[model samples]
Target: MLKVECKKWNQSLEILREEALQAEHPRTRERLMALYEICGGTNATLVGKKTGRNPQTIRSGYIDTMNRV
Candidate 1:
């Protein structure tokens, strides 16, 4: 995951966050939140702890989301 500048990136997740909230599966939501947190200046390790996912999973998921979007 890239290092996020919080002030610059936090509010930019409106669309992604909405997609995350509307996701039906628990894993998908977790993946989306990992992306959200990463883009919000939260480190992947912390995001993993918060979301109960592995840090690598957070990073990979964020990258995957980025590729898709």
Candidate 2:
């Protein structure tokens, strides 16, 4: 079970890396990087405050936007 979870996590990381690579808009890329930095393993609230967005909103929107691409 842990191995499966690890695999999925790795795959998600790969997707994020690809998205970052393909990002063209400076703002979008910045937002994505911020989201990545916060969501990578740290506290979400800290990121939200730093970005001037609600944590839940930023998390949901970031995931939604990334999944769309």
Candidate 3:
């Protein structure tokens, strides 16, 4: 069970990373990271405008992506 879960988690992380790379805007991923940093590494909407996403979207996306790891 643990092995299965780990495989799933790894796959998810790969998908998320690919999505980030294919993002329409280059700064979208960067903004996500910035927000992560601004929120004390917890993730927050510090640069919403730059990211082209609202606080909620950014938070959810970041959480989803991080969870894959």
Candidate 4:
């Protein structure tokens, strides 16, 4: 049920997708891809399934990073 707080995003979905693709680090790409998916209306659970990650990682870890920015 976790959702992305899109208002806080400084970058657009296209930018996020591009950066995710270009990201060299595996962890960084995963986080960016999670954000990109969430911003595009895919929920955390679904994104987690797609990425083979725990939903909480997307909901709390990735999304929470945005809060600190």
- Quantify all predictions' global Cα lDDT against the true fold: 0.68, 0.57, 0.48, 0.84
Instruction: Give lDDT tens digits, candidate 2, residues 1-67.
Output: 0011223345465555566567999767656665566546656567678878787766666654544
- Model 1 CA deviation exceeding 4 Å by range: 1-11
Model 2 ranges off by over 4 Å:
1-22, 64-69
lDDT per residue, candidate 3, 1-69, as tens digits? Answer: 001122444444445455556678866766434433443433355445555668665555555554455
Misplaced by over 4 Å in model 4 are 6-9
Measured by TM-score, the strongest candidate is: 4
Cα lDDT tens digits, model 4, 1-69, are: 665665676678888899999999999998988898898989988988999999888888888777666
- Give the TM-scores of the predictions, in the order they appear: 0.69, 0.49, 0.35, 0.84
Query: What is candidate 3's CA lDDT for residue 6?
Result: 23
Q: Best-fitting candidate, measured by lDDT?
A: 4
Task: Estimate the Cα RMSD of every predicted model relative to the unseen true structure.
Answer: 4.2, 5.7, 8.1, 1.6
- Ranking of candidates on lDDT, top first: 4, 1, 2, 3
For the record, the alpha-carbon RMSD of candidate 2 to the native fold, in angstroms, is 5.7
Q: Is candidate 3 or candidate 4 better by TM-score?
A: 4
